[model samples]
Every structure is written in C-alpha cells, then in structure tokens.
Target chain A: MNRNRSVFLLSALVFGFAFLYVPIISMIVFSFNESKLVTVWGGFSVKWYGELFHNRRMLEAAWLSVRIAAVSATCAVIIGTMAGFALARFGHFRTRTLFSGMVTAPLVMPEVITGLSLLLLFVALAPLPFIPDTRGFSTITIAHITLTMSYVAVIVQSRLSSMDDSLEEAALDLGARPWKVFMVITLPIIAPAMISGWLLAFTLSLDDLVIASFTAGPSTNTLPMMIFSTVRRGITPEINALATIMVGIVTIFVITAGVLMARQERRRQLETRGAGR
Target chain B: MANPSYVTLGQRILAGLDKALTTVMASPPYRWSQGILRRAGVTGRTLVIAVPWVWLLIFFLIPFIIVFKISFAETRWLGSPPYAPIWEWVEGHALHVKITFANYLFLLSDSLYVQAFLSSLKVASVSTILCLLLGYPMAYGIARADPSWRNTLLLLVILPFWTSFLLRVYAWMGLLNNHGVINQFLMWTGIIDEPIVMLQTDFAMYIGIVYSYLPFMILPLYSNLEKHDPTLLEAAVDLGCRPFRAFLSITLPLSKPGIIAGSMLVFIPAVGEFVIPRLLGGTDSLMIGRVLWDEYFLNRNWPVASAVAIALLLLLVIPIVIFQRYQLQEASGEQQR
Candidate 1:
C-alpha cells in the first residue's frame, strides 16, 4: 500500500509540474529560434532579443505599465491597509457587512463587468469638474486600484485577525497614544503582510489586460495591451522574446522572496529555541 | 539668563508662539475639542474606516449604480455620450423621465444572448470541474510532501501566475495551432498521418482555462489539506477502513470548505472570461463577456451593453451572496475555534 501511494504521488508531481511548465519552457526555447516560423527550430540566435529592444512602441508601453503599476500599488496599499485595519479591529460596526462585501466583491468579480462599469463611470463623470474627460493613465490607475485593493485588504485583514491583540493593548497600557501604539507595535508586526500585499497589487496591475484595455485611451496602451494586439495579428518571435524575459524576471523575484522567507523562518525558529533555553 | 541676551529674533518669536499654543491647549474650550476628537475615534479607527469607505462608495458602488441606470436608457448614434439621458428637464418646471425596458426585452427575446449566457455557464462549469480533478492530486501531493520541499513546490505553482497572463495564453497558441508544436510533435512520432486542428476550438478553450486557473484551485486545497490532522486518517485506518475509504470518509468531508471556495474562485471569473474565449475558442464560442465587449466596442451600443452587464450581475448575485456568507461563517468559526 505504501509503495503504491508513493508511486501515485511521484507520478502526480511529475505530470503536474510538466503540465504547468512544458508550454512555458517551449515558449522560452522558441524565443531563441532563428527561423521566422516559431514552430520550426533553426539554429539558436539572439536576434529576437535585439529586435525587442529596438521596438520603441513595446518599450514605451512597458515603461508606462511599470509606472502605472507602481503608483497604483502604493495607493492600493494605503487604502487597503486602512480598510483591513477597520475590518480587523473595529468589530461589528453599523456597516460591517456592507464594508466587507464591497471590499471582497472584486476578488471574484469578472474583469469584463468591472471594465465596462468603470468605463461607464468615467464617461459619466467627465462632465463634472475635477474629473478627467479622457480615459488615459489616471483612469487606468484608478481602475487598477479598485481591482487590486480588494486583494490587499484581504491579505492584511487575514494577517491582522490572526495576530494577538495583547501586544497592542500592552503598548496602550504603557501610556502610548493610539497612533503611536499602532505605528510602534502593530505596524512592525504586520509589515511583512503589507509588503506582500503591495507586491501582489503591483503584479496584478501589471498583468491586467481586459480592464486596462477599457480604461486606457488610444495613446495610453499598456504592455499587455500591446502584446494582445500583436498576438492577435499573428504569432511573432518578438513576443516570445518578451515572454521569456518576463518569465526570467518573475522567476528571479519569486525565488528571492521564497529564499528570504525561508531564511527568516529559520532565524525565528532559532531565536525561539534560544529564548526557551 | 545669559542665553536670553543671545537669543535671535526668530528664536524669541518661536518661543512666544510655543507658549501661546500651550496656553490655548490648556484652555477649557481646546480641551473640550480634544475630548470630542478622542470620543469620535478620529485618530485611527474612524479615519481608517472612512477613507476606504468613501473611496469604495465613490469608485466601486456608484459605478454599479451608474451601470444599472444606464441599462434603462436608450442607445443613440448622434450624441456625445452615445446614450439618451434617462431624465431630462422639460419646458417650465416640468420634469420628463424616459426609461425603457427594450434592452432587457431584447436580451430575453434574442436567441444569441440566451445562447451566449448558457454557453458561458457551461464552459465555466466544465473548466472548474477539470481544474478540481487535476488540482486535487497535486495539492494532496504537496501537502503530504516533506516540509523542507513543500514551500519550494508551492512557489513553483505560483511562479507561473506571476508571469504575464497574456503571454501565457499566447504561448498556448503557439503550441495548439494547426502548424504548432503539438501537431508537429505528433506528426514526427507517427501517431497520426496529418496534423489535427486544435486551436480555435472548445477543446483549446478548456485547456486554456484549466491551465490558467489550476493554481487557484490548488492553493486553497493545499492550505486546507496541510492543516488536516493525520491522526484522524490513522484512526480511520485502524478502524478497519481501507486507505481510499479513510480518505473518502475523513479527508474529503473535512476539506469541504476548501472545495467550495476553490470552485467558486475558479467558476466565477471563468464565466465572464473574455480573453480566453476570444483568443482560443472558435467563432461560434460566443461567451457573454465577448458579447458584451462586441456590443460596446464593435456595435457602439452602450445601453444594450450596460443591460447585458446588469443581467450578468443579477445572475451572479446569488453566488456572490452565498460566497460572502460562507466567508463570514468560516471567519466566525475560526474565531470560535
């Protein structure tokens, strides 16, 4: 029985990993193909990478996407943290249900609906003072913030809820003001979750296509928008090169984060052991 | 006393202002205002709640209302907004409100809209089930793996999710197209005489969705399974149950919450997925998301598009409500435990 179980697990892992990775690996490999046709493997070459770098439109879209993601992620973290703290600390307020519902609704809300509704909103608000008349960078950023803040809120809320409250209460007992207590005690404890939330928001903003498409003006195309339009025209080696580069960057980041977290866990375990001793 | 003579004019002014501010702070009126601020929780809690609350109300909730209202308006070709206003001020003091149910009636009477909605639901449901079938064993494997390897395994699962979603879908196009890698490989292996058509089919669509969303299913399942008590399985085994029986009797029952949560996560977004069906599915794969997109962008009928969105939301309202209630119950249950 044990042998059979082990065999089953081994096959499951092998097949699952392969299924997840083979297409990505193939794409990366084909990115280096010298042939114009992606499926045909000629000798490996770096021409596509060179071509990608010279593509002014693609580069501009990438730069714009990164900028939008950074600003949106920062704003999302601020608003999301506040929403999270309220949901975590202020229990059973008058509009608690409504608050939670609004916060989490976007997590499962379809991108199409969110995109269309927000587009309608922007169009409606155009006549009002202080609202931008054209959908562009600001509009895309706002749409992204609405989409990503919910994720950040959920992350921070879960972290805050799981945390022990006595630490905050103890700081308060020592005569620290509420704000000081939160900054000195609560913030430091939940800082990791906050950072992860920010990263998540950043990646989500960068990855979005549908919502960005609706909110972006003709001149404010994002990277995904560029890539989508290009791919729809037909398969291109430049896209493969772009995809490979993206995969490389994401893999590096994920590995670094994973290693850092593992190291932190080890240190924490060692410190706890020392304290017990 | 010696420093008083050396004090600059700026320092003297600053000292006077500081003293005056202190005196004002010590006054009864100032103290009363401070007390009121504290009672209102303005320092942290209220600010925290109000800031996000106001933002969501303005940007999130109000948009839904606008969409709902627009659904009742008439589409127009010769307008700046492209939709006739639902309410207009008439001559003198009279108010005129023009609301039409034509959009909703059209959606119902039109076979195209009906088919799109049903097809979207069918595709989403099938993809969700496929994700669960493939994800369960993988999640189980990860959960039961050595602790040192578990984190690495989970990272591998999420790594692909961090890459560009469009790129990943595009990658499938390269592999699944007629002259793509999969067909080429099959031809090379002598498994078939000719390359089979795989891209732009329902089969390709299913593959795209299951591949994209399998991580969503696995992560939740892994978290739930990792927390499962092994001793319960042992107890079941010792009670004359086979291994499969033990799993069916104990493990499956305990992971019901994860199953429901994961299914909902995969199903909800898949129903309204635009990119996958547009990129992978054939011309006949008229999902509601694509329909809505075409109506707005291609046909430039904002009112009909808004009505479609409203109809979709209404269809999803029950699931969203149920999911929220489940989340609330789970949170409370966790607190109790």
Candidate 2:
C-alpha cells in the first residue's frame, strides 16, 4: 500500500512537471532550427537570431517595452507599498473598505472589461483642460501601472503581515517617530518583498498584451503587440528565437532569487540553533 | 529658560524641528528642512493613502461607469467621440437626454451574443474543473515532498508565469499545429497514418488555458495542504481508520476553501480569456471576450462592445465578491493562528 501511494505521488509529479515544461523546452530547442518549418528537426543554427536583430520593428518594440516596464514597476512599487501599509496598519480607517476593494478587484477582473473601461476613461478625459490628448506612451504607462500595482500591493501586504510588528513598536518605544521608525526599521525588513514585488510588476507589464493593445496609440506598439501581429500571420523561426531570449532572462532572475532566499534561510537557521544552545 | 510659560507656537515648532534635525543631521538653522518636514507632518499618511485611492477611483472604478454609460449611447461615425452623447443642451434653454436600450436589447435578442455568453460560461467552468483535477494531485505531491525539495518544486511551478503570456500561447501554437511536433511524433510512431487535427480545435483551447492557468490552481492548493497537521492523520490511522477514509473525512473537507479559492482564481479570468481563444480556438469560437474584441475592432460597434463588457462584469460580480470574502477569511484565519 505504501509503495502504491508513493508511486502515485511520483507519477503525478512527473506528469505535472513534464506537462509544464515540455512545450517550453521544445520551443527552446527549435529556436536554433535552420529551416523555416518549426516542427521539423533541422540542422542547428543561430541564423534566426541574426535575423531577429535586423528586424527593426521587433527591436524598437522590445526597447519600448523594457523602458515602460522599468518606469511602471518603480512607480508601482512605491504606490503599492503605501497601499499595502495602509491595508495592513489602518484596517478600520474611513475608506478602508473601498480602498482595499479597489486594490484587490483588479486581480481577477477580466482583462477585456478593464481595458475597455480604461480606454473610455482616457477618451472622456481627453477633451478636458491640461490632459494629454494622445494615447501612446503616457496613456499606456498609466494603464500598465494601474493593472500591475495591485499585484505589488498584494505581495507587499502579505510580507508586511508576516513580519514581526515588535521591531517597529520597539523603535517607537525608544522615542522614534512613526514615520522615522517605518523608514529606519520596517523598510529594511520588507526590502526583499519590495524587490520581488518590483520584479513581478516588471514582468507582468512586459507580458501584458490586451490592456496595452487597448490603450496604445496607432503608431506605438509594445513587443507583445508586435508579436501578436506577426504571429497571427503564421509561426516562424524568428518568434522561437525571441521566445528563447525572453525565457532565458526570466530563468536567470528566478534562479538568482532562489539562491539568495536559500542562503538567507540557512543563515537564519544557524542563528536560531546558536541561540538555543 | 526664556520665560518658560511664554513660548509661542511658532517658536515651539522651531525648537522641535531644531532638535529633530540636530539628531538626524548636523545642520545649520533648522529653517531649511522645516518646509519639507512640516508638510510631511501635516499630511504624509493622508497623502500616501489618498494617492492610490484617487488613482484607483479615476483610472479603475470610473472607467466602469463610463463603460456602463456608453453602453446606452449610440455609435456615431461623424462625431468626435465615436459614441453619441447621452445628454446634450438643446436650443433656447431646453435640456435634451437621449438614452437607448437598443444595445442591451440587441445583445439579449441576438442568438450570437446570447450563445457567446453561454459558451464562455461553459468553457470557463469546464476549464476550472479540469485545472482543479490536474492541479490538486500536483499540489498534494509537492506538499508531501521532502522539505528541501519543496521550495524548488514550487519555484519551478511559478517560473513559467514570470515569462511572457503571449509567448506561452505561442508555444502551444508550435505544438498543436498540423505539422507540429506532437502530430509529427504520433505519425512517426504509427499512432495515426495522417497528422490528426489538433490546432484550432476545442481540445487545443482547453489545453492552452489549462496549461497556462494550472499554476494558479496548484499554488493555492499547495499553500492549503502544506499547513495540514500530520498528527490528525496519524491519530486516525492509529485508531484503525483507513487512510483513504481519513482523507475523505478530514483532508477533503478541510481543503474546501482552498478548492473554492483556486477555482475562482481560474474561473474568473478564464471566462474572458482573449488570447487563448483567439490564438488557439477555431474561427467559430464564441467567447464573449473575443466577441467584444471583434465588435470593437472589426465591426467598430463601440456601443455593443460596451454592452458586452457590462454584461460580462455583471456575470463576474458574484464570484468577485466571493473571492474577496474568501481572501478576508484567509487573512483573518492566518492572523488568529
């Protein structure tokens, strides 16, 4: 019976992980295929990568996406951190219910509804005084920030609730002002969470296609938008090359985060043992 | 002391500022930092809270209102706004209001729109069920694994999520196309003489969504399962209860919230999935999201598109509320523990 259960579990893990990874692995493998046909096994070559570099449209879109992601992620982290703190610390404030609802409602709201609503808001505001009438960079960035900041807020909130509150309280007891205590004591502890929150926001903005498509102007295109246009025509080796590069960057970040977290856990365990002795 | 009882409010504030500045930074007269610190003191917390609040109100909540309003307006070709204004000022101190139920009536009366809503519900429900089935076992397995291996497994599950959503869908396109790797492999193995039709089928659509969203289902389940007390199962077995029986009575019931949370996480977004149905499903796909996309982009019917969006939001409200309540319960549950 024990053997059977273990086998069942092992098989489940195998099946699930394989289902998760096989398509991605195959995509990576095919990026180097020499032939135009994506399915067939051809002589391995990096020619498609060279072609990708020369594709000015793709390069420009990729550059635009990176810049938007960096700016939006930074802004999201700042705003999201504040929202997270408010939710954690001021749970019974005047507008707490509505504030928290607004923060979390975006997490599962359908993309289409969100996109339409945001575009409509922009249109309604366009004729008003002092607002930009265009819908390219600033509009898209604002849309991205709204879409992604909720995610950061949720991340930071969970981290804040899990942290020991006494550190901040101890600082307060020692005559530190509330804001000063948050800056000097609380911020350092939640810094790791903030970093992860920023990474998540960055990647989500980079990955978004639907919201950006709605908010973007006729002339500007993000990378995913560019991919959607081309891939609609047909799949090509160049897309595989692009996929490989994107996946490679994500993999590096994931591994680095994992290693650092593991090291921190180890050091904490060691300190606990020493204190016990 | 300069007449201890005669200090003015301004001088008192200055003294406090001087002391604070001298502690933090070796500075000249404290007048320079007062402008910054005084403002911070006045409205720092309120400013932080209000910024996100007003942002969400302006950018997130108000958009829904505009969409609702536009859904009642008329689509106009020659107007600055594509939709005709619902209210206008008429000649000689008269007020005019135009509200049409045409878009909503069309949406309800047309079989295409009705069928799209029904089909979207069906697809989302079935996908959520499928994700639950596949994800539960995987999450259970991860929870049962050695502690050293568990974190790595969880990380592996979430790594793909960090990659591009469009790229993940494109990966499916590579695999399910006629001459794609799976079909080619099957034919090579003599499983079929010809390449079986996989792309642009309902099967491909399910696979795409399930694969994309499986992590969502698993993560919540794993978090729930990881916190299970092993002693209960051990106690049940010591009393001669079968392991399967114990799981049915204990593990299953306790995981109900996890199951519900996981299902909502998958079901809500899956209902309005645009990319999966667009790239994977056939030409005849009737997802409300795709319909909305077509109505806005191809048909240029803004009013109808807005109507479709409103209907979708109505369908989602109950589930969104359920999800919100579940999150609150979970947070409170954690705090109590």
Candidate 3:
C-alpha cells in the first residue's frame, strides 16, 4: 500500500508539472513551425521569426511600450522610494496607518475601477491648461505610475525598515546634511530594492492591458492591446511568434537573476567563514 | 537631485507657505506622534507622503465619487452624466434631481444579473476549493522536504508568474482547444475516440481560474505548513489518533488563516474578473464582470455601467471590511507576542 501510494504521488507530481509546462513548450515549438497552423507541427524553421521582424505594427507597439515602461518605471521608482522611506523611517505619525492603507488600496482594487476612475479624473481635469487631456502617452504613463508606485513604495519601505536606523544617525553625527547623508548612505543601501521595484514597474507597464486600453488615446495603442485586438481578429503565426519571444526573454532574464542571487549568497558565506578563520 | 522644473505653480504655492503653519494649521493638523518624521529627512518624508496622497485623492478617490454621483443622477438621452446636480429654485425649492431606484431596480428585477452574480460566486468558490485541494498537498510536500530544497520548490512555483500572464492564458488557449495536445493525446491513447469540445465552456473557465490562482494558494499554504510543528502530528499519532483524523484536527485548524487568505485572494479577484470569462468561457456563462464590460463598451450604457460597478463595490466592501478586521486582530496579536 505504501509503495503504491508513493508511485501514485510521483505520477501526480509528473502530471502536474507536465500540465504546467506543456503549453509553454508547445508555444516555443510552434514558433519554429514553417506552416501557419499553430497545432500541426511542421519541420523546424526560423521563417516565422523573420516574419516577426518585418511586422511593422508589432515592432512599433513594442517600441512604444518600451518607452512608456521605461519612463513610468523611472518616475515610479523615485516617488515610490521617497514614499517608502517616509513611511518606514518616519514612525508614530497619527495618519501613518491611513497613509499606508491608501497607498495599498490600488494594489487590491479591481483594474476596471482603477481604469474607469482615472479616466473620469482625467476628463474632469482636462480643461486645465497644463494638464493637456490625460489620454495619450502621458496619461498612460501617469496611470502606470499611479499603480506601480504603490508596489515600489512597499518594497523600498520594507528594505528601509529592515536596515539599522543607526546608519543614518552615524552619518548625521559626522556633520552630513540630511539630503547628503541620504544620497551617500541610505540610497546606496536600498539601491537594489529600488532597481527591483523599477523592474517590477517596467514589467507591469508593459503587461498592462486593461488600464492602458481605457486610458490609451487613438494614437497610443500598447503591445498587449495590439495583441489582444489581433487575437480577436484571428489567431495567427505572428501571435505565436510574439508569445514565444516574450516567454523566452522573461525566462532568460529571471533565470539569470536567480543564478546571480545564488552566487552572491555563496560568496557571502565564503567571506563570513574567511573572516571567522 | 532637485529638478529645475520643480517650481510648478502648485509647488511654488506649497513651498511659499510657512512649514510650521502648514503642519499645525491644516484642516486635520499633521499629528507628529508617528516617530518616522523626526527620524527620516523631513523634506523627503513630506514630499513622499503629501504628493502620493494628493495624487490618490485626485485620480483614485475623485473618479469613484464621480461614478457614484452619475449612478444617482438621471442620465441625458445619450446616457451620460447629467448637466446639473442637485438644485433648488424660487418655485417652491424646485429640485432638478429626480432620484429614482430605477437602475438598482432594473438590476434586481433581471434574473440575469442575479444569476450572473451567483454564477460568479459559484465559480470563484469552486476555483478556490480546487486550488486548496491541489495546492495544500503540494505545499505540504515541499515544506516537509529537506530544508535545502524548499527555496528551489518555491522559486519554481513563482517562476511561471513572472512571464506575461496573458501569454500563459494564450498558452492555455492552445492547450485546451479541440485539436489541442491533451485531447489529442487522450484520443490517440484510446481514452476517448472522439475529440472533446473544451474551449468556450465552463470547464475551460474553471481550468483558467485554477491555473491563474494556483500560486496564491501554494504560497500561503507553504508558509503556514512550514510553521506548523511536525511534533504535533507525531503527538497525535502517539495519542492513538489516525493519520487522517490527526490531519483534520491539527493540520487543518492550524492552516485556517492561510486558507482564508488564499480563498479571499482568489475569490475577490475572480468575482470582478472580466478577462477569463470572456476569453475562456462561453457567451452563456453569465458572470457579472462580462456583463459590466458589455454594458460599458458594447451597450454604451455608462449610467447602467456605473450602477453595476457601484453594486459590485457594495458587494465587495463587506468582505474587505471583514478582511481588514481580521488583519488588525492578527497584527495586535503579533504585537502582544
């Protein structure tokens, strides 16, 4: 009975893994298929990839998404890092809980609500001279920043909270101005958190469909929005190629990060042992 | 690091105000009891708190209020926001606002709306249950593994999510179609001679929900199971309780919080979900989210859309309130600990 149960569990594990991974494997394989039919495997070829490169709309949308993500992430990181530092470092404020909750509300709220609300706000504020009808790239970027900043703040704040408070005090005692001390000491320590937060924001902005769709002007269709509408038109080899490329890029980047983190951990352990010796 | 463009009209007005006056004389005076302000650099702290708060109020809170207002006001013939809000005139305080329960009445009267809401709840509940069933065992298996293997297992679980979620959905699209691998393999193996039509069905929607939400279930379960004492199970066995009974009595109760958190995470999102049902489920699925989408986009009934949104929000607020109280209680307990 015990042996049978073990076998059953092992099979279950294999099935689960297969179910999770097979579709991804199929996508990668079909990207190389010479024929257009997504399921029917043809001999492997790079023709689809070649075709992918020539698709002007796909390329333009990809470029536009990259620019939006980059700008939004940069803004989000700065604002988020600053907010995170305040919430985590500044303690015992009467409205601290309220502030924290407000920052996180966007994280939990439905995208529909977030998108609709932002759209309404933009319409209401459009008459202002400087605001310029928040509907194009700027509006999308602003919406992305609004959502992504909350995440950035949470990450950086946690990092700040975990650090020793005395590090800042030590800098202050050395006659460093508050801003100087922060730039020199505190910022460097939490730089990784900020970078990760930026990366997260970038990914989020790139992947956004709902909010981007709602806020996007006539000229500002994002990659996901394009893909969605394209898929709605009909599935094609081009869509398959795009999915394959995205999966490959994300998988490679994440694996590299994982490997780098592992190496850093090992090196840290070795250094500690060397010090002990 | 200060931008030269920081001198916006708004920023200039803010900067020109006396700092002490701003802190002490604001409508609700900034209470200094939070120890953070004294510790962190004051200028940075102020900018961080004040700017995001103001942005959230303008963009997030104001939009919801606008929607709420539109929900109550009578729409124009084109079904947009009314020109005038509540008003009074010389003619015996004439009220332009003719508030009607018509929208709410329309929603409640339609069996479709009620059915859709019920269907959404049913799907979310089933998906949550399915996630727990599969996820709990997997989490247990991982947590009970050698300590060195735990992180690797956890990473593997999270790895799929980093890829674009839409891509994952697309992958499922290919996998679950009639000519897809699962059906093809089953047919080839003589498990069934005929191809099953799985796409655009409730089964497909269920699979999509479970697939998307599996990680949420696993992470919480893993955390809770890792914290549970192995010795408790041994004690139960030593005290003559069967393994299943011991699991029910000890393991299940211990993991209640994880279960609650995971279920809420899955259920709440699933309730408002538009993408999965539209993509995977058939037209007859009758989920509230897809209905809202139809109202807003296809039907161009903005007033009705706002009403549906407000109705959903009202429904969701109850669970959110409960979750907040639960979190607060847990936080206080931790403080005591």
Candidate 4:
C-alpha cells in the first residue's frame, strides 16, 4: 500500500479505537464526579465507590452473578469440551448434521428468543415431578450454559482441529488405550483453549441481563438485572462506579495474561532458534 | 516416553493408573459390558457425541419447540404457565390437540408487531453495513501492522468486548444524553446553539449497536485479512496495479468469508436487540425484542410474547443457516490447509 493509504488506514484505526474507548473512559471519569448530575463536572470524589461497596443489594447481586458465571462456565467447559472432541474426532456420526445444527444455532440465536424459549420450557415442564416449578438459580444457569457452551465448543473445536495428532497416535502405539491417550495427550494440549473458553463463558454469563431476567425467579436478581433496573430509574453515579471496577478488573487481568503469554511465546521461539544452531 | 532409566513420580503414577485401568477393563464383568456395548455399536465415540448432543437437544432445541407450542396455545392468566396447555388429556384418554392461531392472528391484524419486525430488520441491516464500513479499515490496519504491534492492536479491539455489554451501552448514555458529554462539548464549542437531542433517538440506537458489535465485526475480518499472503499484494504491485484497485480486486474479494461471518455476527443479534433500543431509542422506536418484552412483562400476554419470539426465530433461520454453513466450511478449509 502507498504511504498515503497507510496513513489513512492508521487514522481510521485511531478513530475506531477512540470511538470504542471514549464512552468507557467517560464512564470512568464520571464515576469520580461528585455532582449528582452526570453532565456537570463537579470536583472529583471517591464517594460513589464508597457507596457502591456499602450498597448491600448491589453487592449481593454481584456475588450472585459471579456464582452463576462460575458454575455455568465450569459446566459449559465440560460439556463443550466433549462436544468439540466429538466434532473433531468422531468423523460424521448418524445425527452429526442435527447435532452440529443444535450446537451452532445457539451461537447466533438472539438473546430474547433464547430467553423467552427457555422461560417457556421451564413453565411448560413445571408440572413434571423432576422439573422445578419456580424459575431460579438453576434455570438461569442452564439458560446461560446453552448460550455459552456454543462459544466454548467453537473455541475448543478450533484448537483441536488445528492440533497435531502424532503425540496421540504415538501414545496409542505404545500400548496406551484410546481413552488414556486422550487423557494424557489431548487434554493437556487443549487445556489452554479450555481455560480461555471458560473465561469467555464466565464473562458472557456474568454480562447477560436479558436471559437471566427472563429465567430468574423474583428473588434471583443478578448484577446486570440490578444495573438495568437502576438504569431505568436514571443515570446514577453508583452504576458508573460499578462499571469502572468491572472494566478495571477485566483490563488488568487481560493485559497481565497477554504479557505473560507473549513472554512465554518469545522464550519458546528463542529456545527453538537456539537449538536450531 | 516414560523414561525407564529415570522414572519420575508423575510418570510412575500415570503408569500405575494406566495399568490399573487396563486391568479393570480386562476384568470379566467389564469385558462383558464392553462386548455388549460394542456389539450394539455403542463405543466411546458415540458416548462423546451423546452428552453435549443430548444437552443441546433438551435445553436449546427443545426450548424452541416449547416456544412454538406455547405460541399456539391460548393465554390463561391464572396459572404457573400463564398460557393454556396446547394439548390436554380429557375423559377416555384420547389425544386432544387444541392449536389456536389466535396469537399469530393478533400479531398479523395489529400493525404494531409487523412494524416492529420491519423496523428491527431495517435497523439491523443498516447497523451491519455501518459496522462493515467503519470496521474494515481498522481491521486492515491492524492486520498489516508490524508483527510486534499486531497483538496489542487486536487486544485493543477485543478489550471492550470483554467488558459488560450493558455497561458499554450505559456508558454511551453518558456520552449522548441531552446534557451528556457530546452535547455539552458541542454547545461549548459553539457548534450548535442548542443541545441536539442525541439520546433517545434512532441515531443513538445505531451508535449503541455499532459500538457494541464493532469488535465482533473487526475480529473476524482482521483474522481473515491477517492470513492473506503479503506476497500476493507485492505481485499485484509489481504487475502495475493501482494500490486501491489492488485492494479491491485482491484483498476485498479474498475476504468475502470474513465479511459474511462478521456481518452475520452483528446482524443476527441486532434484529432482536432490546436493551439498546429501549435504553437508547425513544419510546417511539419499535423493535421486535422490545415489543416482545413489553408483551410478556407489561401486557402479561405470554402467548403473544411467545408468538413474537417464534416470528423472530423464523426471521433468523435463514441467516443462522448461512452462518452455520460458513463455519463448517471454514473448519473444513482450515483442516485442508
């Protein structure tokens, strides 16, 4: 590309990044504003942060959100890993097309539809003995898993597909059973993918407001639901404070992970290069 | 290798477990069960497929079926399910199927539902185009950036995605509200005499969807662009093709899959978007998702809400199938490569 085109491209990127970050940055900046009005630039204060911590409902909701996210992510990773392994290794089964359809459909299915459908399912099956009559933690968690497992399946499937099979084959050749080979060889190699998938699933579950709103019982108010209800009331500095904390935690975690991964990758490259000589 | 000369504790334990597992598998009872299962063609492969498959069948697939069924049932306000059963056993145990199209008829007769569906489609399509236009250059720049900087740029694109979607939409409220940042800044700069109503408008809703879903667009496009062979561009240049022309002829054509994938990612969800429209758009803005939410929560009309969801799913079937086809093809392409 020409230098002019390159400059234009760089500017476009700058503009895009600015567009993405300015809203978030404004939220962070306003979180510290002492004034009740969000528009006015009152002198900076940490009062909202303090208030956010003391707010028992918000804290409880946050804790509930975390619990739901953790449980859903763990379950999704287990089921999704199995799904991914089957897709990559099982070579076309009898119902492969239908199975694939069910797995991929959720990834793009709109949240409202997923939420409504699940709520309907819960209500429809209410009369059954095994089914819970009241929608609660389990219902919401199951709804989250249906959405998040698709994501995990996609992530793990990609990793498994690109993975070399020589180590697995060699293990099997050396008197190891197929299951043993998988446990020792395949699992470790795909562990990183699974970890990342778990994180993705956890965040998605935590961030969800719509699906949980539909499936949550009267008592099960998650963080996003709380935020949504509060938002409907109007702009509140406490929401800003909460947003700041969430963005801060996620940013720190992601950057630290990225840096560590990059360093490890570079070291591996260096080792390989050194051994090549 | 277990390295017999120097067996580590980990290796020893692994070996011991493997041996124990093999012994257990060889035992008569285990062998008998295995033989029976094998004779029935129920192997580990089938077992792996059974779990996630059955889970999706119940939770994902079956829920949609229930939604469809509920949509056909009449509303009954005084029950756990505020909708009447689609079928019920009455005297003598003969099968009874009571399927009503009343909900669907209500949807069709009222222009509101139809208008909401159309408006949602329009909004989703327009926002998808906006995302593509805005995201393409950013993806290209990052894809062509120095190797060392690529990861950071890509991370920057995806970082917003990891944050709360609701929070991001909420953050935009701080920017676009009447007295929000943009209006304040514009008024201060003398760009306008009065605060232009930025929030609670179609424009604000567009901004919300594009801002929220842009990462989804860029990531796929960037991954596709990043894999394009640089040598091809060099060759085109050597052959005296103009820079922009080369981009159009070589780069754009090559990234069709990415474009489709990214567009589907944005478009599919944007159609049923509730929070963005309800939170950002005016009360006048009609989206199927918001309409459905209102139907269920405000009106306490479960059958109507179910009908709306069924309609939205029907609308989405085409795009969802396209996306599935693309993903499967992409997977196969990767394996072939």
Q: Of the candidates shown, which would achieve the greatest TM-score relative to the real structure?
A: 4
Per-model RMSD to reference: 6.9, 6.8, 7.8, 3.1
- Candidates by TM-score, descending order: 4, 2, 1, 3
Q: Which DockQ values do the candidates obtain, in the order shown?
A: 0.49, 0.53, 0.30, 0.66
**lDDT tens digits by residue: candidate 4, A154-175:** 8988888887677888888899
Best by DockQ: 4
lDDT of 4 at A11: 97
Please give the distance, in angstroms, between residue A229's alpha carbon in candidate 2 and its true position after superposition: 0.8
lDDT of 3 by residue, A161-191 (tens): 6667787999889897676677556876686
Q: Candidate 1 or 3, higher TM-score?
A: 1
Query: What is the lDDT ranking, best to worst?
Result: 4, 1, 2, 3
Most lDDT-accurate candidate: 4
Q: Candidate 2, which segments miss by more than 4 Å at Cα?
A: A272-277, B1-42
Better of 3 and 4 by DockQ: 4
Off by over 4 Å in 3: A1-13, A160-181, A269-277, B1-44, B77-100, B229-246, B322-337
Per-residue lDDT, model 1, residue B244, is 86
Q: Which residue pairs clash in candidate 3?
A: A90-B36, A91-B34, A91-B35, A91-B36, A92-B33, A92-B34, A92-B35, A93-B34
Put down candidate 1 lDDT per residue, A148-233, tens digits, no spaces: 99988888888888776888989888898776676556776676788889989999999899999888876789999999899998
Q: Give TM-score values for chain A, per-prediction.
A: 0.97, 0.96, 0.89, 0.95
Q: Which ten residues in a row have the lowest lDDT in candidate 1 chain A?
A: A180-189
TM-score of 2: 0.93
Predicted complex 2: CAPRI docking category:
medium
Accuracy of chain B in candidate 2 (TM-score): 0.88
